[model samples]
Target: MNQYPLWKNLLILGVVLFGILFALPNVFSQDPSIEVSAARGHEVTEATPDEVRAVLQNVGVPFKAVEPLAEDKVLVRFPSSGDQLRGQEAIEAHLADRYNSALTLVADLPGWLRAIDAQPMYLGLDLRGGIQVLIDVDMEAALEQGLERYTGDIRSLLRQEKIRYLTVMNDANRVTVKFGDAETLDKGRKLIDREFRELEFETASDGKNFDLYARLAPAEEEQLRDFALQQNITTLRNRVNALGVAEPIVQRQGERRIVVQLPGAQDPARLKEILGATATLEFRLVDTEGSVQDAVEGRVPVSSRLYYDREGRPVLLKRSVIVTGDQITNATSGFDQNSGTPAVFVNLDSRGARRMREVTTENVGKPMAVVFIENRTVTEMVDGEPVKRQVRTEEVISVANIREPFGRRFQTSGLDSSEEAHNLALFLRAGALAAPIQIVEERTIGPSLGQENIDQGVKSVVYGLAAVLIFMGLYYRIFGLVADLVLLTNLVLIVAILSLLQATLTLPGIAGIVLTMGMAVDANVLIFERIREELRNGSSPQASINAGYGKALSTIVDANITTLIAAVILFSFGTGPVKGFAVTLSVGIFTSMFTAILGSRAVVNLIYGGRRLSKLAI
Candidate 1:
């Protein structure tokens, strides 16, 4: 009755072996290294290794090896974290302003193992060194910008339809188009109702002016805000990916706030530079009929504006924008056909492509300009005091004549270098932020502190496991040894599942593991006690063993199911560390039940199932 079928035995053995294979990678740990990725144009080629070696040699910084990675990246491995830091600084100093370098911990597993794509579970910011930033998005500014765009759209619509309008103005939250007569206002309202379904238009007569007011409905406003937040999150994720940060976290914290955690991020300032800046591109016609000198001398035309280029030369541009950066679906950096100089190739979305075709068809051979706009924040010391300031810069990056009525794909030249072209392409491809974000809080965790936390967490788990093993072994005798083996197997299965899933492990996750260790043997304890009761009742040894597991199964299932429900709830409603704890706890509960009930039974049956005895070991 205690014998397990051959298939059952094989299944258990297979699971154990599978767990061992996945869990073995963790034993190799990670090595201190510096990850080098191109900031913009330069690719990481085979020559990069030699350059890195030369730099290290020049600076007297020792390194183990420099290896090229995928996606134009490279890794410089060092003997220790100290050497990693020193070598990174040396390389940065030598390269000057060429690449973006960050200190990272990479797995030192054998190449054969990596060939199969086996990797260790990622560690979170709390467990590894990184930067955590809290950003608050400006929703009011977003709304105002949306209203301004609406006003511009209404102005263009009226002009296109040849409808007479006195003025179109955007105030705090609404756009008002005033007509000279009520008839014109009615025509404008009908046109808006047919074209713009997202806006609610109302007409009114204020004695002399017949005005049509347009505003977003309450539901539309709410949707716009949500869309802005989500769009910013997506944009930030793209920017972080371009930075080549491994396992970065960019998630919405609340309605208007976002939380960003970059694992193994060494330079917070550089991160802020990328995350905080709002970069976008706009195309408009160059106003050749207007005088730039007159505009610069404060005689600006109403339909045109004056802007400076990268070299501080003023130019006149039409006030209307042809297309914005958000309309760009793709961008790539390559050499121009005729000049062979570096340039950016851009592809527009369907609507943008149509608009481009229309505009170019109307104004062929006229000069057009691509304007690059960036808003950034600078912090500096002023009169021995820390001060923060916001700065906005707009410059024309490219100017070319529209050769024909082409759309969908176009190229922009006149960039300073290939690096600038690459950087611009990356920015355009990432899309523009719907709203600006301000960094309200920033925190950095040093690698040494992270290592200390890891050590303490490991010690806690080891001590807890040792205590549990000793208690179970002493209390249950031979049967207890079987339980101890199952407990170890449970730990392995939990780790293997975690590694296979590639879940991030945090410090709180360690606590969950320690708790799991204590809880793993509960089912075994119940089974052992039930068997003892059966023995006291004078049942046969085999019968008692069979009855113990049968009677204890329900209790084990009931206890674990209830706790699993709690873990699921925690995972659903929790954030960050709490969620991390819940994940491990949930996984542990399942693994423990399998190992304690089924695995232990398989082992016991193989050992004591074949024959009867006068006395049992237990």
Candidate 2:
């Protein structure tokens, strides 16, 4: 009654072999290596390896091998961490102008295994060292910008409604419109109140000038701040993706803070540079009418502004901007067709396009400058003490004569390097933050802690498995041995499944695997107990073997189904580590059920099925 078909036996054998093959990759260890990548406008040629070798030799740092990697990168493997660190430092210091180097871990898997795509599971942030950045969003700036927008809107509204206003300006987080008389003030107040529902209007008159003030409601301000926070979070996510970071955690921390955790990130300086950058571009007409020396002497024309280029050359540009980065719909980096110089191609929205067309049509053959503006913090010595200062620097990156009236598209050349072009394009494509953000705190996780976590997690699984195996082997003799064997297969199946899916295993995921070991054998215990009961009630060996599996099927299914539901729920609602735990737990449930019931039954049938035995070894 228990004899299995040939197809069933082959299927079982195939699965066992498949599990072993895919799970073999985890046995390989990683080597400490230095990754070298070319800095902007540089290429990693075959000579890169020789240059790295020579640098290491000169610095007295030992390296096992040096090889070129994909995407214009190089990898230098070292036998020890000391060698890796020393080599990385030497390479970075020596080649800082042309290349960037960092210490990273390279897996030592064989070529054949990699060829077949047999890969190990990715570890999460808790198990792999990464960087955590806490950024403070400037909510007050967002509110001020909102008020400025209201000022512009009110100016347009007054002109359209023929209600002449003397002045409209934003100050103290409020838009104040100055009117000549009470009649004009009353008309503007009614117009603003009818159109802008989110603003509260108040009026004051100092004998002659009538001043009308409008401020955002408290609820509206709160919503605006929340929107800024969310927008920054999305922007950070896009920037992280551009950096090629894997499995990043970007979430809102508080009312005006964002938390970004990038797993497996090694370059802290680059991360800081990109995430803290508030770079934008503005197009303005070169002010040929304004004298440069007069502008430098602080007698500048009211319609012109002074800025410096990358080479420290001063340029005069019109104060009115034709278009800004906010209007850019897309930006990409490439080489110019004719000049072969690095360039950034830009696309603008409809509104910006219309403005560009109007201005270029009017000022054809005139020079237009692309101005790059960035806000940053600098430390300078003041009275023999270092003081931090917030600075806004503007520079002219490109200036070209407009040949024809064009709209919606343009290209900017004259970048210092291809790297700068790429970074500028990346920032523009990712979209600017709603308001400014400052990195208030940063922490870099070391690989040593990640190693400790991995060691402890492995030990937990090993120790748990050993204790269960010993107990099962001693409790029920022959059947206990069968359960122990299937438990091992179940473990292999779990590893294989996780590897195949390439899931990230966190510290909590390790805990789930350990807990699953105990749960894995619970089904075997139930089946063994049912078999023992059948034997005591006078059933023969074959009959009890069949009866044990058949009757316990319902109980095992019901139990696993309930636990699986819980895991699914956790996976749906949880984030980060909780999600990792749920994934491993859910995978374990399926693998354990397969090995406990179908696998163990197949083995039992081979040993005791279709046999004549008067007694059982239980």
Q: What tens digits encode model 1's per-residue C-alpha lDDT throughout 465-564?
A: 8888888788888888999999999999889998887777888888888888777888889998998899999998899999999999999999999989
TM-scores vs. true structure, each candidate: 0.75, 0.80
Model 2 Cα displacement at 615 (Å)? 3.6
lDDT of 2 by residue, 252-296 (tens): 987899999876554444665576566778898999988998988
Of candidate 2, the 10-residue stretch with the lowest lDDT total is 379-388
Question: Whole-model lDDT, candidate 1?
Answer: 0.82
lDDT of all predictions, in order shown? 0.82, 0.83
Task: State candidate 1's TM-score.
Answer: 0.75
